[model samples]
Every structure is written in structure tokens, then in C-alpha cells.
Target: MPQPRSHDIRRGRYSEAGRSYLLTTVTHQRRSLFHDFHHARLVIQQLRRCELERSCRSLAWVVMPDHVHWLIELKALPLGEVMRRFKARSSLALHRAGVPSQRVWQAGYHDRALRREEDVLHVARYIVANPVRAGLVRSVREYSHWDAVWL
Candidate 1:
């Protein structure tokens, strides 16, 4: 099979400070089973650890069966470093749980920095509402793998 096009995998950069960002990452090979609700809960726990250790502030998050969406306030660390530590820790946890050795996150993640005029709370609501929007649940409360500080 032909390799996917580079454009299909390219991610943009965010260089501004004090900007809230919405980020998303998918499991390797689009494997939905790799991150079930229980695993998603664990991922959230790990993220909380990263928050305490790296000083990140998570506004909202939703962990889908195959991917995750997070809205976070970049604190003391650079966004790149924050995401690196997050992925590394989560990958290690998943590996120890017997996830495939070849399974790993993609090289880059998707991030959209909010403009100064944008409403951070609105974006956070959107992040938490992903499961409903995707038709995975009738309501955000029905989803077992989502959380937010404001909610």
C-alpha cells in the first residue's frame, strides 16, 4: 500500500505565551480498544500527576475510545515539553499494561491556541462535550472518561 501523504499528518505550531490550547492525540493504528474507559481514567490520573509535577492546569478533557482531547492552561513549562512528558508517561504506563510494543502515539499532536478574545470556558465546554458530539453518549455525564474543573 502507498504511504499516506505528509500533508495528512502535518501539525501546526503554537508559539504564544499564556494561550489556552486544545490538543488531541490518537492511539497507534487507530486502535480503539487500546484506551478503554478504565485506561482512560488511568490516563487522566497520569495527567493529574503531570499537572502537579509540571505545573500544567487542565481546564477540560475527554478521552474517547481511540483518542483524547484536552484543553489546558500552559503554566511554567513550554507546551512542547508538557506534551512530551505527558505522552512519555502515558506510553510507559500503557506498555506496562501489555499494550503492543509497536504501539505508540504519532510523532506530533494537534493543538489550537485560543486567541486573546476567545472564551477559554467555551472552548473547555467543547472539549468536554466531544463524546456527545461524536454520538458515543447521549450526554457528557454518560461518558465515563471525561472531566473538567469547571464542570
Candidate 2:
């Protein structure tokens, strides 16, 4: 097996408007930065901003200690642009919140475009269940950093 090249990340990628995608982006060096409530809320604010600006409709999202899992329906922009803006804005927000790290996120994100027949609710359940799966919380209800439209 061959290792994937960095440029291959975007190979054959297409961003169709109105399509749902699950995006995961990790913090730089996978540092558990979201452990602090304020730091985590800052990132959450950026997610809300993306929706408010009509970039994407957030179906579900969970701000884990070191990464974020967001299920969103692409709106007006391409997936790359939406992610670029989100990362930039979130980095700025973290800086403004007194987080000294200049680099908040890793270079790129992972996105899974959902097929029309896929069960969106099932996917959302899996997303919200991340905290429980990671053993950070006993139940989804106990996780403070996650949300889903169905829940």
C-alpha cells in the first residue's frame, strides 16, 4: 500500500450546494484545548457564526477536547471555502479569548459527503454519542459540548 500525498486530500472532491457533510478537524498537535469551558465555547460561537452567515446549516456538532465533528448542509460556498473561513474565524476567536496559540487547527479537515439514502439521524446520533464513546461522559445528555437537530 502507498501513503497518500498531501495534495491528494482534495483529489476528486466536489462540493455541491445543499449536500450534507460530516466534517472533522483536529486541533494543532491534537492538544486537548477544548478542555476549558471558555475555550470550547469560543469555538462553538464560531460554528454559530458560520450558520448565521449562511455558510452552512449545522445539523449536528460536537466540540471534543481535541477536535470537532460537525454535520452540516453546505449552503452558498464550496466546502473548502466554508472550512477555510471557519478555521480562520475560529483561530481569531481563540486568540481574542486569550488563547495564545496562533495555530488552532491542523492543516486540513476530513469530510464525508452523505448520500441521499443515508440515515442522517443515525449519523447525528453517532456524532452526539462521541463523548460517551470516548468515555468523557456517561451519557449524551451529560456532554455539554455537543448538539444535534434531532435531539
Score residue 100 of candidate 1 by CA lDDT.
68
- Cand. 1 Cα-lDDT: 0.77
lDDT of each: 0.77, 0.92
TM-score of 1: 0.86
Using TM-score as the measure, the top candidate is 2
Clashing pairs in 1: none
Q: What is the lDDT of residue 70 in candidate 2?
A: 99
lDDT of 1 by residue, 59-107 (tens): 8888788888888888888777787788888888877777767756766
Clashes of each: 0, 0
Model 1 — which ten-residue stretch has the worst lDDT? 6-15
Instruction: Give each model a TM-score.
Output: 0.86, 0.94
